[model samples]
Target: MKLYEFERAPNPRRVRFFIAEKGIDLASIERIQIDIGGGENRAAEFRQMNPMGTVPVLELDDGTALSETMAICRYFEGNHPEPALLGQSVIEQATIEMWNRRMEFNLLLPVAMAFRHTTGHFSDRENVFPDYGSDCGQSAQRMFDFLNDHLADNDYIAGRQFSVADITAVVSIDFARVIKMRLDPDKHARLIDWHERISARPAASV
Candidate 1:
């Protein structure tokens, strides 16, 4: 398998972190670095593999390519199920999926939209809808508050155990920094504590 990725990109980092948690042998898989800022992902050759031209594409040995971080992670979890990042039971799996989707939509998407709309970083590369920037930032903050309250009682995003929900939350929280959305120590003590604990994990460094 070949993983085409860009270092420091939030989505790709999710896969790297997931792979690390699964104790996957990096040597067994080929790693291809794509220059996202340089628009290499937009090139025709790369676009052939993924029409969306997104990073963190996993190309299987059979020449099939998988896009989207969560889908790729699901594939990995299916093949390597011992660590069980998804969940063990039916209820647990459903809960993890619920929380994961919530984090992606309520937290991650808003933060990303805010950054893309407000910052000039991708102004030349993609369309910038500045009119929605404020709304997006506000939505992200609302989700942060929601998560902070939830974290007050629970250690992880889903519930008791660390799951893919936690991974999504951690990545979203860190990525939110680009839009200047952060966990206020006074307002989100529990969230901050959770973040600190997740950050200390070995997979986080990956």
Candidate 2:
């Protein structure tokens, strides 16, 4: 499988983390990096693979291109069931899915909005709304507080197990930093501790 991605992007990094946690040697998979900032992702050749023009597309050997981070992840999870990140039991799966959505909606989406609207990094492709972006930054900060409280007792995002929800939370929290969102050691003690634990994992570096 060949993963078309921009490694620095949070979405691609999420998949990389999942692959590493699954005990897969990341180097074994062929990686094709698309220069997102240079409009490479929007070009005709790339758009043919993923109409949405997003990175982190996994192309199968048979020429099937799987887009979306979670979709790509689900494919791998199905293939490699051991040390399951998406979960095995029904309840575990539902719980992980719930937490993952929460992280994406409350943290990841807001952070991306904040960056796009405030910095105009993709202004060439999309409209910039500074006021709305500022609001999104404030909204994302509330999620930081929410996670801090929720993680006070839980070892992972989906409870005691390190699942895909944990991966989402970590990536969202890290990306939030781009909008100047910081999990202060004193203010977000529990969240900070959780971040440190998650970051220490070998998969986190991937």
Per-candidate TM-score against the hidden true structure:
0.96, 0.98
Residues 1-206 of candidate 1 have per-residue lDDT tens digits of 99999987889989988988999976688889999889999999999999999999999999999999999999999999979999999999999999999989998888888888988577878888887977899999988889889987898999999998888889988988877787898899889999999999999987
Query: Model 2, which residues run further than 4 Å from truth?
Result: none
Reference-based TM-score, model 1: 0.96
lDDT of 2 by residue, 1-206 (tens): 89999988999999999999999999999999999999999999999999999989999999999999999999999999889998889998998999899988988999989999999999999989999999999998898888899987798988989998889889988987777788878779989898999999999998
lDDT of 2: 0.92
Return the number of clashes found in candidate 2: 0
Which candidate number would show the highest TM-score if scored against the true structure?
2
Ten residues in a row with the worst lDDT in model 2?
178-187
